[model samples]
Target chain A: MSNNNYVKNLIESGMRIDNRKFDEFREIEIKTNIIDRAEGSSIIKIGNTQIIVGVKLSVGEPFPDTPDEGILIVNAEFSPAASPSFEAGPPDENAIELARVVDRAIRESHCIDLKKLCIVPKEKVWNINIDIQVIDFDGNLIDAACMGTVAALKTTKIPKYENDEVDYEHREGELPLVDLPIYVTIYKIGDKLFVDPTKEEEEAADARISIATIQDGKICAIQKGGTGYFTISEIERAIEMSIIIGENLRNLFKH
Target chain B: MKEKEKLIINRKRLDGRDLYEMRKIEIQINPIKNSMGSAMFKFGKTWAIAATHGPRAAYPKWQQNPEFSILKTRYMMLPFSTWERSKPGISRRSIEISKVVNDALSNVIFLEDYPKTMIDVFIDIIEADASTRCAALNAASIALALAGVPLKDIVSSCSVGKIDGEIVLDIAGFEDNYGEVDCAVAMIPHEEKVLLLQMDGIVTKEEFKKMIMLAKEGCLKVYESQKTAIKQAFTNIIDIE
Candidate 1:
């Protein structure tokens, strides 16, 4: 039997290959301040999937449109170390999509107080760059990457800037974060919908949707991926699951 | 922003459209004779042309599948499409859009019939005023059908947004730049299911649901227009014969 059929058969019978509930997530581990050179850094492991995220702050001129707000850039690299499919060149479509989805979650949630990062309106502002590196290949990279990024951002500190120069050694204030946005991705396999699929389950998914929600249960960003279709009821169920799972994930930051 | 002008004044948008009104849409079939199928779709100021090429044998050999054909789509915006000349090359944004558009149309096309083949869809935006992806998909769907490609259902798409505390439909022009939230949706009307969905910006859960419904209504309207254009094209061909 093919992997798709085997996975589908298992899911149809309310069984996942990893033997977890449909909405259950694998064990997650997060460690912060792992990189001394970066302003902030974290490594997150969700099941077998491991990702390292680093946050860097630099002074630069703002974009022409939103000059008064600080800039937030997200980039993701799927290193060859993580999987045999990955290459050592520029980012691929999946990497680009991963970065953009995480970017939308952060930007749309209004989590970071961008205006507060502005040093000189329209002229100079602090640019926050979040770089996500995949160290292990597994399923649910989107959720893992988002969690790694948020944890890294939470630990980021602003470096001291004086006399048109940045003094990296004298870091002072923390990143102006007012809210936390948690991302949840649900995969639809056959007639069932589940969260946190393993790598094998991901290969069998017919469709998937990633949603980002804030503390108030307000949706900030959504991306429906894959070639399969979904009914309205399925979409609604996905939203409900995301909100419930997002709340649980947010509690991880209470410490 | 306190002193900034409102996007909607007395329920009228900047382009004289109401809260749920869509801009005028026009579609022309087989605009490029050299290709297997081609179409031009316009939504007010935004224009997209799509060309469908062969179920030709897949190149590089390794990319071909023994069981089914592969579908590839490329979406590009001309340098002069925007106010500021966009750089002439593929950007990450275009790459992502292409992938989504490909996926949106993938299930609808009957790829199993053509083994070891590839169907290529090229969409170019000659003009842009937001919602370019929706317009491009509309054109591609029609072009594929005209090219003798079998499809289960036609795909239609539209976008809705939140601006000035009100959910509105068919967001265009300056509304995209100033809107608080934007949601684009594509649907297969016959199947009664959504094929594509994407959103950015902020909105309450209630408003998000409203946006999806409103965008669906807008897509149905586009579907009506597509039906008329396709019928007219066939009628023209019959008259010629």
Candidate 2:
């Protein structure tokens, strides 16, 4: 449509409504322990987008195959208050995609030492439940959620086990967090790339790629979304942008 | 009885309130400006919001009833609403609560007026400790009013329970979890008629009678606040205009 062409033309002219460069992120803010009941929690805001991540630790049996390691469950829910488009029922595909992408980044990057989370081997293990609640929606929900989850896990304090029983209210020690992995997403719009696209820009984008980089600057997870292709040179350029952007994001957490 | 010390101690509830004390209740009308009518209701730490839309049209035409408009209600809780990160979906508990709330609200609403149309009640818990369904029903009633729906009288809900061998008004999350015999009651004001009642755990018949009486007394207070919230909403509309 003519509207799409107008947006594309604006992007091609190196102009953004927000008056920022193509590879720039929105102003981000992060805070921890806003939720009173949860042991570990963080709230992240990227531009107008807001996400709160709460980490709950429970004692339960480990999986049969991975008996020695603890379990990590990540779930995301798009609250109806965040946007009019999101319904009040169960989480839909967008929520699921956000959860899976962030989960994959944390799980595959060897970020949290799951083995260290075990209590009595197979008999007892700590079950970590990381829940992402979309408080407000503007754009770039996945990146904000990922930051919140990581910051929350970093601040997580494991419950004390006394006499082989776990106490839910009492906190004992910090979680075994090994490496910090940062999530960076880049969108291709009208033969150009942009970082942290706003909601309107995202709707205009042809395709987007997300990369997760760990402490050592190595790519850990990669996901490509939307129905657009990228050339080899573009992919390399995106990777370079991710590395630099990821390092800045990594410094937000306590080293 | 799962954990006595966690709920009651020396005849006092965990939050250090008397047996008949209710958690702090707050009701703010029309929080979701995009919806026709909306309200955010809270009891102690638990919070839920209700947004009502439609009275527009019924989809597909087959499900429409000629005699009355339909009310489609969904009671949902956020994943971070609970301390232990509740699952992100409509659980059996939520489904049952939706039905119970819908039934309670249906009793007072003038549904027959909006023929071939439907109104949606979307109640989402932003936080949770206990008695979310009751709060949801209370908020939904206010939401319907904001939607300008016809009603006999606005409904209000509260929960009364027997804890430490004593009947109490408005049991909180920990009390409901560890206490015995939680009875959720929804009532129409002034007439003092019961609209919905569900008993969890067990109570003797004599104790049940006392609990209902206690719940009615609590419901009257809830009804007062519901009226106050609606008035405040009206005041806000005037201020906006």
Candidate 2 TM-score, true structure as reference: 0.52
Clashing pairs in 1: none
Name the best candidate (by lDDT).
1
Fnat values, one per model, are 0.85, 0.00
For all predicted structures, in order, the TM-scores are 0.97, 0.52
Output the lDDT of residue B201, model 2.
43
**Residue B194, model 2, lDDT:** 59
Which ranges in model 2 have alpha carbons more than 4 Å from their true place?
A1-5, B1-241
* Pairs clashing within candidate 2: none
lDDT of 2 by residue, B84-131 (tens): 888999875576567667767776778899999988999999988888
Report the number of the highest-TM-score candidate.
1
